[model samples]
Target chain A: MDRSEIENLIARVALKDRAAFDQLYDRVSAKLFGVCLRVLNKRAAAEDAMQDTFVKIWKNADRYSANGLSPMTWLITIARNTSIDRLRARKKGHQDIDTPGFELIAPGLNPEQAVVAASEASRLSGCLDTLEEDRGKAIRGAYLDGETYADLADRFGVPLNTMRTWLRRGLIALRECMSQ
Target chain B: MTEQTDIPRDDDVLAAELVLGLASDKDVIDGRRRMSTDAAFAGQVVFWQERLTAMTDGIDPVKPPARVKKKLLAQVFPKTRVSVLQRVWLWQGVSMASLLFAGYLGVQLLEMNTRPGTQPTVLAAQLVSDTSGLQVLAVVEPVKHEIALRRISGEVIPNRVFELWAILPDQAPVSLGVLPDSETVRVLVPEALRSQAAQFTLAISDEPIGGSPTGAPTGAVLAAGSMTEL
Candidate 1:
């Protein structure tokens, strides 16, 4: 579904139309589930997080229009933020010891290639590619894997301050590249 | 708009940090609070979120298990007005049947108490699978640290062992033990994990023989329910 269709459905969802809510779920649940799975990294927890995401969407659909975001953007923001909250909660409970690593399983292209395809993601991918490969991967890993700065630092074998500097500079470069 | 120039300002950097999930949880919470009051900062964060989310375009979409939608629907539109009326009517019918069953159970418990034969069940959970319509009723005797599991639904897959797990909130699943196949099986809960019985949820997973080799549930969670005081 395109942006307008999703927006209209969300508007109806805000009105408590059960049919529209079902349609919204049908259109977006798979993508949102993938987002949750990547962030939570556990099937059961990801499912729970996805369920909570929809509930939040149902409750907070009215907040969408004021955000000046595309419908999918708004929906994904909710999904990502909810998963991040779950990540933080899990971390607080000291449950990170057994987080199983998941393998990315897309059909045609490898993950990085697919990410850079000339489609909706092309502009962002091109901008990210301008950064050092490690820095770009750090940004992607932070967003996709819900890694903390500390976690990224450990993964990259860099000091925490150096990781932060790399990311800050990388974000600036990405912003500059997107503007062009 | 002036802040959109080549160099990102401090607030823009903060917004980027928050959007990237690299900020500490406290910082993120403060950032959200700032976004509520600071329009320009909020817009910057949304801009970053939209652009970064586009990068996820490559992630493949996997169809969630069928029960997810079913459970979501049940939660979302729990009982329509018409269904509420139907539920009331059904409850009235079931209440009579339940009363009779409760009376019969009372008599059986009284007999057991008088005979000093059976320990009273201290805790119980009815593990129901929304996907498969499987129900396993479990009753625990705290003093003995033993739980009796009875299969309320007879649907069982051959060669797949049913493993029971205890899941505390925000914690990884701790293996309780493998459950029996056909009849009621009384399994002992390990002493170290017994204190968690009251607060945690009991879930059953379909695992290979000898249960989960890694000390965690490796199979689909077939059924789960929270323990309740009995």
Candidate 2:
């Protein structure tokens, strides 16, 4: 749905319309759930947090103000906060969260992302190819593996500052490459 | 320093590094803050967001389970109304059902053509609940004949009722009537009422379970809005 449609529905939801609220859930739950999963790093916990976030949305719908932030931003704020809350609670000792192995946690894209990917694949592919092999590895490792610059530095037997420079230069090259 | 003020080159370097996931947590945090506050930084952010935004292309699309959506819907719309009293004054009143009616009322009152030609001439003041941020009271349309009072259904406190009142210039507030329900709530604007409305206000007061004990607004004013012509 478009921004206006989402905003309109949210306004209706503020008035306690069950149908509009359901429609909003149908539209944004997948992407929002993915965000929850990313932060909590577990499926079941993410699901729980997602449900809690929606409940908050339902109760607090009347509190939304269209000052500057978009509806997605507002919704994402709630989801992120909910996931963070659950994570904090888990840190205090809930062990039921099933964190998958790193290999099993394959980078998953949702539909909006898929469309963006489909449109920009060739350009990005060419850009990724232009970076030096090691530099590309450094960037990909830090990003996809969620590793730190120090980790990349240690993994590659390089100085931390040197690793940082490589990623920086690699990104510059990639930007230039993609624009071309 | 004077020769190095042209920082697009430096910005490009920083943005690319940030996008490549090379920036420190501090770097990322500071950069995002700057992006929001600085226009130059915002442009760089848009450029980087566009470039890195494409990386999702390599990932596979994952469809979550059907139960996920069902769970979400249930969470957002829990099937429960705690009261046997199926009727209450709606508080957060910006319903889509009412917006069209408001627009029509606006046209009939103003006689001024809207949209495609009309401009937002009036600063429409819908009385908002300061705590809940809900637009509870509003001047739906200020017509020569009538003014619609738009309010939602679940706004009334269990033991309270709402009574509408119109404040007049150089005069005390005038009691309109009790808000019976959500649907039929049009208040007649006394023909002489318009000239003074700009200087006056629309208000609602909480009354007894039925209505105001005193024929005037005896309880706390729930919501109020200033009237203006556009």
Candidate 3:
């Protein structure tokens, strides 16, 4: 679904319209599920997180429009945060030791399809291309994999402070690039 | 860096760190404290979250198992659509009836206690909360391993389930399963716990639908009382 359609469905959902909620689920569940999987890195946990995310979306639909964020962004945020919460709630000593490489963006896309994917996607891709290669990768790794500074430091073979600096500067640069 | 430029810059970085999930648990808790008390800090966190979320566009979508959707629907739209207040009213009505029944049962028990021929096997307790003015009267039949719970007063938080627990002396609370939504609920005390019921306290806690996912009480203990043999 396009952005406005998703927004409209969410508006109806705020009114407790069950059909609209079902429609919204059909349209976004896969993408949200992907977000959950990427952050959690476990199928069963991701499934649980995905289910909880939708329930949270249903209960907190009223808190959405007031935030002034795009529907997809809002939805993704919920999924990501829910997954991260699940990750943190795991056993105290548990850590995701495996460092998976970032998933490459889709290889083949016509210009029409790219435009239809939402300008935010295109804009973000363009901006990420402008950052230093390793810095960009670190930012992507941190967000997509729920990697902590310690995890990134180990992956990049950098001191903890250096890893923190890379991420901090990379995020600032991203903000600047996206704003332009 | 001079202290002048450092503060806001540090806040911005902290916000970004929080949104990106890169902060340590301690830092995340501190950041959340700031978010609640500082609007600008919260907005910056939202800004970073919105910007960074776009990168997830490349992650290929995978359809979740069908059971997830089924379970989600079942939870959101349970068969009974009783509102909390309505349930409370219903429970009150049931409570009044149970009180009368308990009165009858009490008289019968008194008579049974006075009788010379047979012995009766029944145990009872009253769980009360002075702050909320909540009361629950529990009568147990050890042989049958069942406890009848009657809500005497107060109501549970809407949209959450109440789970009954057996808090044994010097032991952690053991779940007795979720209380029924109605005013009167009959719960089969778990076999392992039946013999120990009289030695433990009965408490109810507010939990998410389907009870505590962790198999333990995660919410507040709304009411509790020690069991007393009648």
Candidate 1 docking: what grade?
Answer: incorrect
- Which candidate wins on TM-score? 1
Candidate 1 chain B superposition, TM-score: 0.49
- For residues A61-105, write the lDDT of model 1, one tens digit per residue: 755552345577667767776787788775553322111100001
Off-target runs (Cα >4 Å) in candidate 1 are: A93-122, B1-9, B80-84, B87-230
Docking class of 3: incorrect
| Ten contiguous residues with the weakest lDDT in model 1 chain B | B97-106
> Where is the poorest 10-residue window by lDDT in model 2 chain A?
A96-105
Give the better candidate number (2 or 3) by DockQ.
Answer: 3
Per-residue error (Å), model 1, residue B132: 34
Best by DockQ: 3
Give each model a TM-score. Answer: 0.56, 0.44, 0.54
Model 3, span A1-180: residue lDDT tens: 488899888877766666788899999999999989998889999999888888888887766662345678778888887787677666475332211110101122234433433454457778888899988888887777767778888999997877777778887787677666
Which window of ten consecutive residues has the lowest lDDT sum in model 1 chain A? A97-106
* Stretch of 10 with least lDDT, candidate 2 chain B: B82-91
What's the ranking of the predictions by TM-score, best on top? Answer: 1, 3, 2
Tell the DockQ for candidate 1.
0.16
Question: What tens digits encode model 2's per-residue C-alpha lDDT throughout B118-186?
Answer: 432232335545553324434434333455655533356545677777787667788777776453367
Tell me how large the interface RMSD of candidate 3 is: 10.2
Give one digit per residue, the lDDT tens place, for model 2 in A1-180.
Answer: 387788888887777676788788878877677767766678888788788887878878776644333466457556654665565463333222111111012222334543443344348666777789888777666444444567788999997767666677777677667655
